[model samples]
Target: MNKVLKQAIRAILPTWRTTPVDVMHRESGIPPVAQLLEARRIRFSARIKSLDPAHPLRPVLLPRKYASEPLPPLQTAAKKEAAEEFNAWLESVSPLTVIVYSDGSLSEKGAAGYGFTVHQNGRSLRQGAGRLGPAEVFDAEARGALEGLKAALRLPQSASQKIVVCLDNIAAARCLRGQPSDSSQGVFLAFQAPAKRHRQTDIRWIPGHSNIAGNEQADVLAKVGCTHPEPMNAAPTLAFLRRGAKRQCKDVARAWWNETAPDKYRSLNLDFPNCCPPELDLPRPVLHHLLAARNHHGDFADYHERFGHDDAKLTCSCSWRKSPTHLFYCRKVDSRHRMRLAPSPAVAIDRAIGRDFEKFVKLAQSSSFFEKICPCL
Candidate 1:
């Protein structure tokens, strides 16, 4: 599959047969088939783990011990409604029920934090917040749910006291009701312990950024947690690990390119192993011209000679040897066009193929411009 995908990439890039596989892959901004399959497998595994107990494939995929243990029934409220309706519902909840509003925040530096405010009988009972180092926002959300449950359990309560945990993240709220499958499995499991003891516990999802007082307070506390001096030790979640793997892959590919890529390609100073090049979203023909020019595999006399093509012409119409660098100097091209290129050959090529790609595309699409630049094409 990888071999086939590489072949397709080469065709799309219109690069020479001898172009490095890594160069084609990077230029096309496509991952290896293996990497794609691994990502899919990870997603499928998470889905299977989150499946309902009654799902036929769930029993088959899971171990016998896990398959037989029925997931505890969790009361959930995830309906989408207007802010007015939600406020009305909140005001109508029984005064005896403990309402815990939880929220999660992610810092710019990748720190995750959780915060919760517990309330009852129209008054605040307590508030808590904490940081989880090097974790995802989803992990923080799950942690918030767990911590909120713990806080509600610690409150002085009568026999009729029930608990409702409200979270702004629907995914986190829903995940709590299902069997634990993600990186937050431990936190979710901890939440289940208290929830089982207090059978009247309910998990609810509220719209985020809707200006509710409790939700806003929880948001502020979560931001405070993000700035905490010390973060608690927490294992990296599956999402975090996947991101690391992707970065490592790119690093490896870049190292290989630096060591083995031809000097001609290296001179352009293009970002190697980039998964999303600027030209990627452009029209296919436009992208093809850019890649071909960058790789020096299109309409060049030296390229044709190297590949033993019959119609190879060593010199341009103005008698200069046809080469990748000759495009900026070709006298047949209009002085106006030449003025558009940078004085430095490397910068000129880089801009033509990358930085100024849209302009390059316009020129490439013009028959007069393309013919003057490369008559052999």
Candidate 2:
């Protein structure tokens, strides 16, 4: 099945048979058959997990699990509104009221971390930071909120005293307000116990990077946690694993192309996994001509001779061999049409195969331009 798919992709790219599979996959941005099947399986499993408890297929698909505790009350507001509300609430609260700020960070290298700061009135009381190793930012956010709540609970407070946990990630706040179904289920469950015991506890959302002091402090602490020497030995989330898989596939393909791609193809210097190139949106025949020119595989004397097309013309009307580079210098093509594409021959060829598509599409679709260059067309 993948072989058929590969043939179809080659036809679309209009590349030569000698083109490496890695190059084809890199240019097309289509994963192999196995990767696609694995992605489908992951999606199916997630669907099963989202089904209702009473669903008949739920038990058949997955083993029965204990029900999660009800989530704490959540308060959310728009960015500007949230900042204003939070500031007003801070001014009105007593010195005894506990306010906790939490944040999460993910590094470019995929390390994840969480940070929290617990405060009373305007004074900082406690702060915590930790590494979650190979985890998603979502997990880090939930864990940070959980740690902040735990620190707030440890502080001495009356039964009626208000405890508010503030975070910038609204999705994490909403998840804590609902059932726990993601990879961070254990952390959410742990948070539920203390929150349920304290009736005055509430989770609140605030806009991140809005110049809030506590949020900024928490953000710094999270970055610090990312540089920690040791990481927590926690199981990676399903989402994290899925992302890693796709990234690995692309990395392997890129490495293969860099090490073994033909010199002619390598000279183009195209990036691997060139997903959604603007040229793909052009009309089909125009796209075909553009790709053929880029790959050096269309209506050229060398290509025809290699494929044993004896009847095809070997040279242009100007008596020069029809080749990819000849399109730039062929005097048989009208100089006006050539200059419309580019002022210089080098720039014209670069624009034809480069990332910019606007000029290339115009030149390719221009009446009689390709026909003048290659009479065989």
Candidate number achieving the greatest TM-score relative to the actual structure: 2
Ten contiguous residues minimizing lDDT sum, candidate 1 = 59-68
Global fold similarity of model 1 (TM-score): 0.69
For model 1, residues 175-246, the per-residue Cα lDDT tens digits are 676666456677887887778778788787778888878888999999888888654465567656665565
Query: lDDT tens string, model 2, 47-94?
Result: 555444687465323233443675443445667877888788789888
Candidate 1 local Cα displacement, residue 236, angstroms: 4.3
What TM-score do all the candidates reach, one by one? Answer: 0.69, 0.74
The lDDT values for all models are 0.72, 0.72
